[model samples]
Target: MKMTTHQPEHYNNLQKLCRICGERRNKGRPYHSQTFETQIKEVFGVDISDDRTDVHPKYLCFNCQSQISEPSNKVKEIIPVEWKGHDDDDDCLVCDIKAVVRPESFAVPEKPAPKRRKSEIKITVVKKEAAMKLKELNEHIVCSICSGYIVDATTVTECLHSFCKSCLVKHLQTRQTCPQCKILIHETAPMQYIGTDTKLQDVINKLVPGLMESEIKRRNDFYANRGLSVPLNGNSSRPITPNTQDSEPAKFPPDDGRTWFHTNDLKMSLCIEPVKKELSIPQMPMKFIRCSMKLKVEHLTKYIKQKTLISDEIELTCNKKTLANDVTLENVWLETWKRKEAPMTLFYNKKK
Candidate 1:
């Protein structure tokens, strides 16, 4: 015998209820498997399966089914970074280093501190004070040659001699030697007159001690030189030109004592110069004088050659530093004899 199929009267009703809950229908998608966690998603919202397995087996959508299971352990928990408050006094948990917990009594930082100014320093500077004392302690000395007080600071003469303007002028007029070193005072013009002032004091303070000693020695040597030894009264008068013979006159021929010379004599006899054989002088070839410029050039060239052939005549003491002013002219003449001769062409070239 064949058996007949049986249909439950509530089948359609159960299907309609499943559609409302968004569960998968047997005719459509399959149901979620029996996993430890699951999510059931519905058009309305998600449904969750509790940790308890005793709950009834229920149809669920994929989204709602996933929500039902215990929340995914894969997702990480996010906590915000929390800054500790000043009052909280909580230690940092991450870094091992300790941060100072400033106290409430501490004052807030204001503007940065100002730098110290050296000029404003109130400390007593011994060196500067000593310098000041030195300046005051120094006494002004009179120049022996000029009889003038040495007041000018920059006006120290070559011999370490110093003097007032009028006195120096008189000294130069009368003497050429230094009042200090006895070395020849070559300079008529003093170094430069500068009375002691702030600027001058600074300069003096900066000068080395040894240089001052040298300066003094130079001046002493100058005053001791022979030229400065002329009598004071004699110095008052005009300086005397140097003479070869103090009292004698130059020699020349007397008028009437010479032997007779005929009128035909090529040389004439005068009272000053008696008849003598005519000297044969070198005569240049007879050439027409051209431009005056050319003649001058030739003369200048010869002069330069003579000058170059001679050397300086002035002599100084071995250790002496300066040339004496009065003796300088004589010294020049002395050196002229040894000077290396220069070509006349040099002078002519210089003119061009």
Candidate 2:
């Protein structure tokens, strides 16, 4: 006996069929007994039974619905079977398929690369205090004449007290006593007593910065104020030139031009005598020239050597006594030849 399969009224007029397998249940076969919508709703939790509205319904065949309900082997690999115990039905079969295809979502979200902490650093400083006080410095480097810090420092031989070179020179131009102790430095030529204290100068340079340059500037300013030419060294005192307008009355009347001359400008006769006959004269033995009070005995020996063509091996004597070269001609005249108006004779003796 042949039996006819009963088809639903909805399947007879359906234009759409199962979305997964594209199959319809219109054929008179027993395998097409169930509607595709019912199978899809049971497996994937989607209802496609109603067809009254404009929205199209999606359907899945019984075979495709059965395959979707079971988790895929790929999905099982990423999510363990034990995870089913905690399964929530809200996640649909479409969501399970996405998780199977893209497995990165299930991986333990790479525990956000351990937060790096910066190391704390500390710095230490050590401060040192000055060892000496400002007031205590005065006892060591104070100058007597300026009563300040000594610059271009000089020391007196007679009395051991220090002063600035310029200050001492200016003071000694009029006075012959030490500025600090008032002790006699020299009876005459007070400048001869002052000497440069190199040790003290070095100490001052170390103690005070920029002192030497400032001293040179001050000496330059002193000469600039006086309208005089500054010395090249800037250490020595300026030479004093005699002013004829400020001179005292002449010792003799104006008619005597020879007597009207200053004592320093007076002409004196120098007679050079050679002890040995072998030495020839460079010029005349007797020379009459203007004499300066500042001319020393050494200058006369030099002049005699030039005139008499004698070498430095010759020694000179005045009044049978060996003349000290440092003694000035004016000093020798006052001591020995003040009464003699004739040419002052210098006898030369050859050194053996």
Candidate 3:
């Protein structure tokens, strides 16, 4: 009785078929960059996936690769190369069968030992397409206080939530908690804890087209109207010291209406700037004002009204909170003012 031997499957795919167009790879290039694969699909209008129905041939013959690489108009002449190559070892042309081979002469070849493979990391490419609206990204870019796109973006140190610098400053005058997260920005002084969020502000500027230009114009107009120089820094809301000789005030009128400080009175140097559209005496917008600390809040108000000559009532605030008519500047200095520095800064808006 004659015995037929079975060979192991390792004999398969020692030479792979081309992955792009199924052809027996002889002088073909191995699959290298995914870019070529993408080009093949885009130019040829043929997905490489169909050719890769089986695992054997993950390479590309030079002919097909060259065809895919050439410009589309020029490449239309050659490709869609019909290479329906076979994968089975039996189909190998090297083992050609002569007519009437003797069974006894046929011997199974010894399988070579498998080589050790080095560890490798495989990377994959993922592509997803979707649509998103500008409003959806409010948490990252919009100010919770203004309910608008953030300008001069500022971030709270305590909770890390961000808002427009002016809006947050305005809100922080009355509230101690973060507008978005309700986290305690500061138990005492929130402004001290917050700083410019440069990166976030940059991103916000990019996302909103023409927003930066509009803001620049608005700020320039505010400074122009108030007879104050707009700060070169993007933080335009902060108070600036008046430029003068002998510490004389810049925005106020001549010494006639300026406060007469008593010899013993504790004077507080104040930087009173305006918010958007905040009107001053037109002639005397408050850039730098000198007042006695012992005076009541009403005295300061009357002093400003008398000096500016504006008949309409005006409102003043430090840290965005309004001052009471009866409270003294000394109390505001000792208690309400947060900065431990020379000038006590304040912001004012039209009485609303």
State TM-scores per candidate.
0.19, 0.34, 0.35
Model 1, range 1-352, lDDT digits (tens) per residue? 1111211212222332122132223444544333422223322232334311221233433433333444463233222112221133323211111231322212233788787798976897666444344444334344455443332332343434444433554454445554455566554322122123334434443542444445444543443443332222222112223552212211121133654332211111111110122332122232112121112223423443344332223222211232233433222222322212211111011110
Judging by lDDT against the true structure, name the best candidate: 3
lDDT for each of the candidates?
0.31, 0.54, 0.60
Q: Residues 122-212, candidate 3, lDDT per residue (tens digit)?
A: 5677978888888888778877788889887888998888888778877876678988888887665455677788898888887888988
How much is 12 displaced in model 2, in angstroms?
95
lDDT of 2 by residue, 56-148 (tens): 224433445445556352232221111111123333222232333224422333567765555544456878987986558876698866778
Taking all chains together, the TM-score of candidate 1 against the true structure is 0.19
User: How well does candidate 1 score on lDDT at residue 164?
Assistant: 47
Which residue runs of candidate 3 sit more than 4 Å off their true CA positions? 1-129, 225-228, 233-352
Best by TM-score: 3
Q: After TM-score superposition, what is the CA distance of residue 311 in candidate 1 from its true location, in Å?
A: 41
Question: For candidate 2, what is the total of clashing residue pairs?
Answer: 0
lDDT of 2 at 148: 83
